[model samples]
Structure formats: structure tokens, C-alpha cells
Target: MLHSKSILSFVLVLFISGCSSVVLPIDERALINDIKAKYQGEILAPEDLKKGDITTYSFPPVWGFNVRSYFSRDGSFSLDREFYRFKNEDRGSTIFEHFIESEGDIEKTGRQIILKNRIAYRKYDSSSDLNYLSTFKECEFKLGTCTYKSASGKDKKVKTYFENGVWTSEYEGFRNSKLIETKIYHKSGLLIFSSYKGLIRGNTSYSNREAFEANSL
Candidate 1:
């Protein structure tokens, strides 16, 4: 009963959103195992995902919620991606703006698939998190654990990214649970914005995050 409820909820998210927002895991087998344990279902094998048989594919490098791969029975895949963004603040908006897509297979070092898409979004539309702007700040964050000291004279344990060396971004009262209230900060750490979010969902790394981090140094 619990398993059925979980599957139903996942389906309801697809139905309500009218689109897939789920990210694909790099280890397809782990996803397969998770399905078996959680909902007792399975997805197509990497090579077995054929056109029409699959609508979601996430290959290494090209991996994301982005539509990818049309595997044929002979065990080859095709690349044809065209991700678009909202236009004019409308739902089911056809005033879509064309953005960058893959130029070649996922392994090319020169490929700008991730970078170009980011630029398009940053230009024509505003960045949702403005994560790129963190570069200009006094300090920046990476994945690590840290303690947050609150003004109330309390210490909270958090896997907080960094205050990297700044003070404002720390969690005020972090408790270990699925949802965590996040405190956002300006480049100078003067501005403060706070919001409630599910930590599991917010933990998603953007497509270009790895490359950006490498180049940040």
C-alpha cells in the first residue's frame, strides 16, 4: 500500500506539472535498484531504450532532465536536443526562445553544450539562483560541512556549503530533516534572503556546476 502510494504520487507530479522534472541518475543500475526496492518497478536498460520506447535519457556528460538519446535496436543512439525556455510569463507559452544544444557526443572537451545554455538563460531570462554571480564575491562555496553560529548565541550543525569565509549564509537553526530553511546572501554578504526548501531537491547540481567549479580555481 505504501509502495503504491509512492508510485501514485510520482505519477501525480508528472500529471500536474505536465512535464518531467525528474533528474536521471548517472548510475542507471542504482536507479533500477531503487525502483525495485521503493516501488517495485523497472526502467529500460541503457541500450534497450529505443525511440518511442523512451522519452527520458541521461547519459554521462549529457545527463540531466534534458531529453536525450533515441536508442535503436542495433544498440546505437542518436543526438537531437532542443531545449527551450519560457517566454512572456505565460504557461504553455509558445513564445519560446531557442537555446543551445549539444554539438557532438558527450565526451568532447571543447563542447559548449552546458556553458551556452547557461549564457542563454542568463541573458534572455534571469538566472533563478544567480549562482554564477558568486564568483565576484570575497569568498565562494564548495561542498563541505560547517557549523553555523546564530545571533541567538546558539550553534547549529549543518552540512552548509560555506559561508566560504562569509558570515550571513549560515543556517540559523538547522535541524536534520528532509527540508532545510536556506539563507541566501548578496556578493558582499550584506543582503539576506531566506526561503524554505526541500534539501534533497535543492541539492541538485546544475549541468555545468562541475565545470564551473573546476574553472573557479
Candidate 2:
């Protein structure tokens, strides 16, 4: 009876361990692809656009915007294409005054409105806690532990030992109350890399890593 109990207990321990978040080293290329897939995509402009000035595309689990504009036979916008302001108060006399610098036409690629007020923005449903701004003012170089709240309000803590602005080692999701996420930044405050590990619906669990390079706009 004692031997049987020991075997059963060992099996139970293994099962529970398998169900938990797993952190592993990642490849650079794989990390970049995941970052682009998760973050690089359509972004909305005129964030404060009124409900009426714009038309919304609504679908379960997704939403997008389409401002009314005139088009030519070639599918290019014509001179008739005009946009309205939120109200009679024109902060300044300008229509799409913001410049969108991209290799291709931003409107066609669905990546319009680059560098709002000079700060780059990426689209990720605004759901993932992996936002670019979220990591700001949180910590700095050297060795220490920092705690943050996950999208689901769970305590996510990351401990890092850094040398020369590089994360050498990390203790991610150190406890049950912790969700694992890691971030690295260049000296310029640009996000360089990130990783997240947590549980999801349908018994799915994953550890995702992302690496970002500064893109000139």
C-alpha cells in the first residue's frame, strides 16, 4: 500500500507540473515573426473620431474603421474625398494633417497613420498587456524584480539580472499568483524584445516571445 501511494503521488506531481506555464529559450527569427504576426497590422487614426463622422466594421471579436471618402476608378481617392472633424471647433485647420510615411501607401496596406505625435503605435487589439507604453517608467538597468498587473488583473512579475543593458537571466512567473512576461529595452527606450507565458481557454497554454527592431519611418 505504501509503495502504491508513492507511485500515485509522483504521477500527480508530474501531471500538475506539465499543466503549468513553461519557459524556454527562443530563436531570434521565430521571435520576430511572432511579433509581426501579433502586433503589425491595421491601426486607426483620428482616435477621437466621433461615432457619426466614421463608419465602423463590426464583427464578433474584431472591430475596424472606414472613413467615408471618394474613390477613382483606379481605387485611388479623388479630390472629392473629404473628412470631417469631431466638432465645429477645429483645433487647427487641417485634414489628415498627420503624415503617414511608409514604403507603400499606408491606406492600402491598412497601416495608416504612422508615428502619431512622433510616437509609434502598433495594433494588437489593445488587449494584450504587451503594449509598448505599458513598460515605460517601470524599471531600469541592473538586477531587480518588478511586478505588474496582467490584462486579466493577475499579478505578473519579472525578475531580471542585467549586464550592459542586456537581460542575462530571468525568473519568470515565479509563483502561482504570477503571470510570466519579460521585456528588454534599448538605451533609447525603444522596445527590443518581449516574452509572455500564461494560460488560455480550451486548455491551451503557451509561452510567446517577441523581438522588435527600430523601424525608420
**lDDT, candidate 1, 29-101, per-residue tens:** 2322343344222221212212323222111211221332322223232324333222332222122233344
- Per-candidate TM equals 0.19, 0.31
In model 2, how many backbone clashes occur? 0
As a TM-score, model 2 comes out at: 0.31
TM-score, prediction 1 = 0.19
Q: Which lDDT values do the candidates have, in the order given?
A: 0.26, 0.30
Best by lDDT: 2
lDDT of 2 by residue, 55-138 (tens): 231211111111212122232321111111111112321111122224433322222221222122333332423233443224
- In model 1, how many backbone clashes occur? 0
